[model samples]
Each structure stands twice: as C-alpha cells, then as structure tokens.
Target: YMLARSTGARIIVEFGTSSGISTLYLAAALRDNGGGRLITTEFEPSKVMRAKANLAEGGLIDLVEVREGDALETLSADLPERIDLLLLDGAKALYPEILSLVESRLRPGALVIADNADFSPEYLERVRSLAGGYMSTPFGDDVELSMRLG
Candidate 1:
C-alpha cells in the first residue's frame, strides 16, 4: 500500500491474487491515487472466484481486473504502455520469468516487490546486480525491494 500510494502508481501488475488479500491493498492505493487499474493474475479457478468475490466485497473490483490464468500467459500481452508497480508473490520459482515478462513495460523507477525472495536465488542475483538496471535491496525479513533503473 505504501509503495503503490507513495509512488502514485496508476497501473499495477500483480503476479498473484491468492484470495485477493494483497489485491485489496493495491486496489485501495489505486483508488486513493485518483483512479487506475490493477491487472492481477491467478492460476487457480477457485482462487480466482474467491479473489473476485473478496475484491467486490471490499468495493475494489472496479479498480482491479483479475486475470484467471497463469501469470506468464495473462501478463504476457495487452498491458498499459507504462506500468508503475509490480508485485511478485505467486509461484516462487517463476519470479525471474514473471519479471522478464513485465520488464519492458516498467517505467523507469517503477517499484518491484517480491515476497519470500529467498526462494528464487536467480531472482535475487538478478535484482541485486548493479548492472541489472535495478537498485535492489532486501526489505524486512524476506522481501526484496527494487526500482527499475532504466
């Protein structure tokens, strides 16, 4: 929420919408940012149903479009020309792949947050590298905070 709102992120792409827990926060930030869209992907049909229900219940459904499929597929195309934020919380092993899918669209300085980042050593190494185009650092205990350097 802080990251999205503080950055004035108008378009957000989330790798996972597991039950819409994090979706609500991102959508709320969008709402407060004066209106925007959140494209979130989930692979499980049942979880997609629940996530949609939760978003509607939270009155954030209008601000979010929950894509019900693999993030690799759903987020591969038809995205906004510029994306302001990305949250990686889906399959731990797919972090780098997902980032690659979204990389070109991330506006310079866009924020990328990954949870339990230790699960993807490759992802960690990529983001942490100074020449990878991201100023990356660890946050809290298991989260990675990085900004697209362009």
Candidate 2:
C-alpha cells in the first residue's frame, strides 16, 4: 500500500476481495494520498457482501468499487485508462488471463503483485520471460512482483 502511494498510484485493480483485508490496506493508502479508486472483484456473492461490509466499516467504501462476478467478466470493461497498481490474488489459474485483460491499460512502470504465484507456472514463466514486457522477480516468499516496461 505504501509502495503504491509512494509511486503516486491513483488507480488500483485487485483481482480478489476476500473479506476486504487487502482492500482496506489499499483504501487507506488512497485516503492518505488524498483520494483514489480501487476496483476489486470477487466471484463469491457471500464474500462480496462481507468485503463490502468490511470496507464500509473501515470507512473506505467510498474509495472502492466491489464488483461481483468472475473477474474475467467483471473486470473486462469499464476500467481506468491508466491502471497504476494491480494485485493478482484470485483464481491462480486465471492470473495470465487477468493480466492479459488489463495489460494494455497498464502504464509503463505499473506494478503487478501476484500472491502464491507458484501455483501458476505459466504466469511465472510469462512474467519472468524477457519478451513478457515486464521486469519481474520474486518478492519475500510467495509473491512475484513485476513492473510493466511497455
């Protein structure tokens, strides 16, 4: 969250909103940064409701839009023109497809954080490849952090 704020990130897209734990972090950053938008998706209706409630409780619901549906469908349209940060922590198998959907909108130097990336070897391979258009490396233990270069 601090990293996103430090980089002046105004548009954040998160693939999973499980109870809004991560959403609160991002929303707090947006609040501290004055204002911003967080578009988060969750396919499970129950989780969506819980996340929304959590966001509301955190007083950050105004900064976030919790979309309910498979992210591939929910996040396919109405995205920000320039996405600053992307968090990929949903269905691990769909990380590549999610990235594909948002790749064109990622500004140069955009940051992508994929948690539990080891579950998706293809995603890891794509991001680590020189031809992938991103400079990527493992972060901490299970996270793969990539920066879009193009």
Candidate 3:
C-alpha cells in the first residue's frame, strides 16, 4: 500500500469492507500520501456503520466513504471509469460478477488487488491470464493487468 500510494494515485475503490479492518490500512496509506480518497462498499448497513465508526476511531473518516448496499449493484451504477486501484474483498460467490464489472470499468494502468484470491478458482485463473508484468510482494503478488485510458 505504501509503495502504491507513493505513486501518487488519487482514486481508490474497495469492496467488502465488512468491518473496515482492511479499510484502515488503505486509509492510513492514503492519508500518509497527503491526499487521496477511498470509496468502499458494504452490503450490510450495520457493517457499514461499524466500519464508519472504526474508520473514525482510526482517524480516517474524512478519507473513506462507506457505501451501504449490494457492492456489485452499487459499483455497476456508480463506479467511475477511471479508478487507480481496486480492492476486491467482497462475497466469494459474487467474485466473478465483480471481476467482470471491474474489468469493464478499470483504466488501462489501473491496478486490481484482490484479497482472498487464493480461495476463488475463477479469480486465480483470471488473474493468471490477465497479469502481464507480475511482481511478488509481501502481501501477495502485484501484477500489471491493464493500461489506463488516456
């Protein structure tokens, strides 16, 4: 996250922020970089509130917007065509659907960092197929999957 933020990427979207545990990490990274935004989605309203509270406790409320609703549906309608980083942490069953949505919206140089990817067969295959320049990192592998549109 530090490395990615160092690139000065401005927009980030995250799915499945169940409790904002991961959200904190992303928010901290973005805050460290001086300026950035993290739009995150959670299906459960309660989880959304909890996440918001958690982020607030972590002093990251201003940097993260916790959207409450079906992540896929919300993203399909609202996600911008230009996203710098996308973190997939939603439902395992809906992984494919979200993947397609992300691919359709991702900018050419945008990066997709998936968590629990090892759990999804389709995800592994898709990542393996799409990643052109791959780098093994401490958390997982970073791959240059596509190029952002100008």
Residue 100 of model 3: what lDDT?
A: 77
lDDT, model 3, position 95 = 64
Which 10-residue window in model 3 sums to the lowest lDDT? 129-138
lDDT of each: 0.95, 0.94, 0.72
What is the lDDT for 110 in model 1?
99
- Candidate 3's residue-wise lDDT over 24-69, tens digit each? 9888888887868888989998888899999989999998878889
All candidates: CA RMSD in angstroms? Answer: 0.6, 0.7, 3.7
Residues 79-102 of candidate 2 have per-residue lDDT tens digits of 999999999989999999999999
Instruction: For model 2, name the residue pairs that clash.
Output: none
Encode model 1's per-residue lDDT on 75-104: one tens digit a residue: 998899999999999999999999999999
**Which is better, 2 or 3, measured by TM-score?**
2
Model 1 RMSD to the real structure?
0.6
Return whichever of 1 and 3 wins on TM-score: 1
